[model samples]
Target chain A: MTPTIPILRVRGHLLVSVQGELGDDVVEQFQNDVLSAIERDRGRDGGLLVDISGLEVVDTYVARVLADTAAMARLMGRHTVVCGMRPEVAATLVQMGYMLDGVETALDVDDGLDRLGLPR
Target chain B: MDPSLTEVLQFDEHQLRTRLAFFRIGEEELDRLAAMRPLMEEATAQIVSLFYEHLLSQPETRDFLDDPVLVDRLQAKQTAYFLQLFEGRVDLAYVENRFRVGAAHERLGVPPRWYIGAFDRYLGLVRERLIGRGVAGAELVADLAAVERIMHFDAALAIDAYVAGHLATHARNQAALRELASPVIRVHDRVLLLPLVGTIDSFRAQQVMESALLGVSEEQARVLILDIAGVAVVDTQVADHLLKTTAALRLLGAKTILTGISPQVARTIVELGVDLKTLHTRNKLSDGLELALSLVGREITDKERGS
Candidate 1:
């Protein structure tokens, strides 16, 4: 059986839990899914929470896609909060010159939810 | 015409002419010029090696030396430059030639600062080498000083040309960046507001990331708001910038909020098919402001509130 994308709903916020390798292909699909959710909830007052706990390595391309996704959500009138980014992954993103110009990042899902003004 | 008088007069004339010509010629002149040749060659070679060694030791200059072809070309030019020093006459023509080479480097975008350090070290090496060769007399010192004087004159001209070219390039870049304003701003005591405006290309995106990182650290900001309201479009590239920024801000231990998304930007986000299901973003600047305030444990009334 093909592995399914793990998406959990918390307080009306879509939480996409990513794990393992976040390749360009996987990240592309992930970006599409997040965009779909934002569109579904357009004109709404909620946000999405992304948990990237399982990611070990993020290449320049994947890192860029993740940032772009957050920006796109903001345009959709929804907030994009990413949580559970590994320390190593974060370092790689920094070294690769990834710009998070206008994205929100939190330590964990709880912190991310809180930043989005969502209840635990 | 008189036998005794003619002989005496002819003899006197030849003697006077010979003595006058003799005064014009010096016996030690040829020997002195010849003796300086070997010393000049030795000093030139030593200076070249020392220059290369100093350049290789520097990280910035080392890259320029990585290519074997380029290294060889540079070494050859440097050797030629040294040899030209002792070519007997130090005239305006020689100075002009050196100046032309230096100006060429300036046009080629070579910085003058590196040349100063390299030239200084080269002189020190020449002194050390000369000292080892048992050449410590006042005459030797004078010769070395002359060489240094010529080099300094050439170096100054090169640096001036380089500075002019550098300023021109800087002016152009400044003009471009000025339109974008400062990518970063300090809003609140512990908060930084980086309102990313215009279409952010990859290079500009990197600048934004670096600016944000540096601004946060230098400003000791606890909260960072990436205000994107003025951002006209949000394609995949834009989305990628947001993700990278978010990831980076989290690492820096600063809370980040993405604010300002217009309706047109929203449609682009959907059309591009990017997933931002798990990121914090706000439709308006005020929404982000509220979130930033909460992070700092501050609340605002209706005046600062936005729907």
Candidate 2:
């Protein structure tokens, strides 16, 4: 089995970097891992930042999973910012009718950090 | 009817017959015209010269008539056309020939009134000549009536071809305008501007969407400012098109700022309840530009007065 993606605690905020084309199982595992990380960091004041800059493509299923993760994080009292989506990927996602609604976006990791109230 | 000829002339035999019937020209009238053909054939030269004199008097035609060779050539052609009227056969060939001449005149930018007026002069001169030859009473009236009906019928066919030419030119211009309608401008390093003016029909809306996507991807634009102040109407359909554009732009990682909302348009949007939550709108283009600059991490500041 491929190992689940990593989630790191950076300056009291959870940071997740998703790269390349991840399989459905890997994305689901990452979703569970992110939720638990958000649960464990419930006392933290910062938001969750997801950096997808390394990802070249994102299918509708993966987009849905990310949006779900963001909503779950918000429910846990942590706002989530998904950043670094390439222009083509974003265009394909919107064209495919997967809007990724209810999720905040940033230009890159730095912008994501800035949105999360963490200056870098 | 020849399909190719009818297609080019946009007139079939049935249509021509209908026009002739409308002008009340029947076999009796055609027979009368054919009988007078010899008389008209003899008078063709005199009538054509008189017609040219009238043409030379007009400022628009004087330029073409200045060349003696050209005027002689035109007069020869005009004589043949005048004699053809009294030939008494308004067949497919006759209709096709008239259509071709009309289209040629349109290409040369000759106004309809000039050709119509030329026909009127020819008719008047023909009546005068027939009477001068001592044809009297019912016979004079019959010939004049037959000539008038055929001339008017010919005029109708020519005008049809003229209108067809105009419609083709209009369609060509519209296609060119559509191409220039949507232009995406890259104002800053990572900002693009698309100023939309006029109505947003489905065809133009599709163009706008394609331009926006291509512009955003090409420029790697972080923010796209769409100014619709020149857009006169803000209906539900226009709002829907704008929403789709913004939604697509969002996926491309570029934020869309809609500017140029007149107060009247703002009221219409509210009245329609267009659900503009997904879109970011500004009252003026300048405000949208300011916001777009900030989104791309750049701003204009006053220069230091004393360095």
Candidate 3:
């Protein structure tokens, strides 16, 4: 069974908090879920915020999944701001040469809301 | 250049023999030293007492020998050391023992000048005794030459150990300075300031990366301003390191603003054709801070202090 990632709505912005390492299938499911949530929240100017602070490790595969989700969200007329990325995970991603270049980043949920032009 | 700690510690029998040969202390000198052992043994206690007497007279040396119990113990050790010189068995064991003596003096914080002066005084006493004992001209000169050569050899070993200890301490201090050089200061909430100074080398660049990344994580910082006004040069290598750090910070949800680029460094960066499109740079640290503040969804608005 694929573990489901929590995707909550805060101020109309989708906040996805990833905890621990995810298997390949789980990450794929998360990507699909994030896109579906963005489609469900259509007509509302909400953005995506992924909180990977609790994730101890983020290999290249997980990083690509998040980046892909952000790219798909952009096509649906919504922005995605990745927030609460731990430093070690960032370092690992950078070392592995996987840069989520087009995705916006913020410090936390409040900053994420600010990025989406929402009241913090 | 001073020898490394490993070289000093590994002063083997071959090295000892080479040093003896360098000092021209051949079989003849060893024979002379053995021949004069009885006379030197008789004068050992007197020599040690006289040496300590001269040392105790000096204010600097007197401070180190303030305790009478330690003085007594050291005096006994000095007597044995003096007698060992005349016994003429200058082997690896003997050289190793001399190294211990030098290391002990170094640990005690005794300066080189005092010990050197003490050796001179000790040699003078021995010369005076040899004359007083009615030793003739040619034999006296030969014995004195041997004694001087041996003293020189012992001094070399001790000084080597002393210098090696100092070099080790210098290395430890340098390591501490490297750690201090890269300080990640949290100038504002969710914003960090790393003011880098000195020349950028690969080692220091690694230090900067580790410190900045760890600082961002611990502070949960959203923005970092790296002010490099004090950095001496901006070569391609340095630019590469800075870019790598900036890219890493971006992944951690932090925007890195490079600041404090001097006019010359700016020209060099342009001339060098280093690509810095992904990095945000400002002229001064304050400007960088402004950019950083804005990135974190905050701004520094001017208002009355009372308000």
Candidate 4:
């Protein structure tokens, strides 16, 4: 059985840490969980920090979904930041023509949280 | 119609009949003479100059006819068309010839409004010129009536040609857009085959998305086999496009089977750290075809079936 990924919430920031192959199913679940957390914390200011350190290469679909999710969160008055995208993974995503337009990217989760103005 | 009359008008019997019906005038000598009046007015240098002056005064028409050489050629062509109207031959051959000329201009992207405006100005000049000559009574009215009929026919021809040209251009643009979206390949009832031939880019990826969606919607296809054997190399960009397209297909409830990944492409995908384990990819088109048939619950017999 595949190991369950962990989602840790610190204050108003939600941290999604996955340690396996990030496929379509995993991406769908991650998106749902993040949206649910944002809805649960509605009317309160918060942020989302997605840590993808375990992932080596992020596919085009997931990249697009991440960008879309970030946009959606921003529209709901929530700031979203993506962190720990490996150089190789970032290169792969760039080659795939995934526009990282609205989503903020950082070297690590700590930096990502800092960018969101949330205390680590 | 006499053979000489047909030769001069360059229209067959059927075309002449259609044109005569459009003019609402028969092959009678008086009606034929009346039709010549408009042509005579159009051929005169004074009326032609007046028509040009009016066209040049309008910015829209003036811009299109800015080239002096083109203007000269157009004037020469119009003069010839005018002379043909009074050739004393009312046949389908003459009408067809006129239609062909109008169609040629339409293909050249000349707007119908330009031809109509030019004819309108020509008519006004003819009316002024004839009235100033002290012409009156039924004779003058009959002459004017003939001129109007010929001009109206010419205008109709020009408009028809313009419409045909616009339709043709629209169809061509649609086809190009469709091709850009997806290289569509028709397959048998149980099969949906798409061959990837050239380089794939992001813009092409969107096109592929539209095309694949259309194929799935129209064919109700149970099996979609994408043949990439013709592709030269599978770069990361191309691979990403394929992955996105596959994901989109799945969302639309369509199953996509990729085929024709050369060994080099396999190595590249591995080197790039892209995972293809979730995808049903094959090395050959035939293997993909077999898989597609199995998904559709159909068998490929030894005998070839209709496409």
Q: What's chain A's TM-score in each predicted model?
A: 0.85, 0.90, 0.89, 0.85
Top of the candidates by lDDT: 3
> Which sections of candidate 4 miss by over 4 Å?
A1-120, B1-12, B28-43, B184-307
lDDT by residue (tens digit), candidate 3, B83-130: 888886788778878888888898889888877988899889988988
**Residue B96 in candidate 2 has what lDDT?**
80
Worst 10 residues of 3 chain B by lDDT: B1-10
Could you tally the backbone clashes for each prediction? 22, 1, 0, 7
Residue B117 displacement in candidate 3 (angstroms): 17
lDDT of each: 0.68, 0.82, 0.84, 0.68
Q: Which stretches in model 1 have alpha-carbon errors above 4 Å?
A: A1-91, A94-120, B1-168, B171-181, B270-277, B302-307
Please give, for residues A9-105, the per-residue lDDT of candidate 3 as tens digits.
8887888988887777788888888888877876787777888777787887788888888888888877788888777777667666677788788
User: Which residue window of length 10 is worst by lDDT in model 4 chain A?
Assistant: A86-95
What are the candidates' C-alpha RMSDs? 22.2, 9.6, 8.1, 18.9
lDDT of 1 by residue, A1-120 (tens): 335567667787878888877765567788888788667765556778877767777677876787788788778777788777665566566766664545667666776777788533
RMSD in Å for model 2? 9.6
When candidate 2 is compared with the true two-chain complex, its DockQ is 0.24
What's the TM-score of chain B for every model shown? 0.44, 0.76, 0.75, 0.54
True contacts kept of 1: 0.20
lDDT by residue (B1-307, candidate 2, tens digit) is 5344357765777887887899989998999889989888888888888888988998887885689998898788888888888887888889888887788789888889888988888888988988897989998898889988988888987898799889989999988886789989999998999999988897788778778877876776788999999987878778767777887777555789999988877776777675678778999899899998987778988999998
Kindly give the stretch of ten consecutive residues in candidate 1 chain B with the minimal lDDT sum.
B2-11
Give the per-residue Cα lDDT of candidate 3 at B94: 85
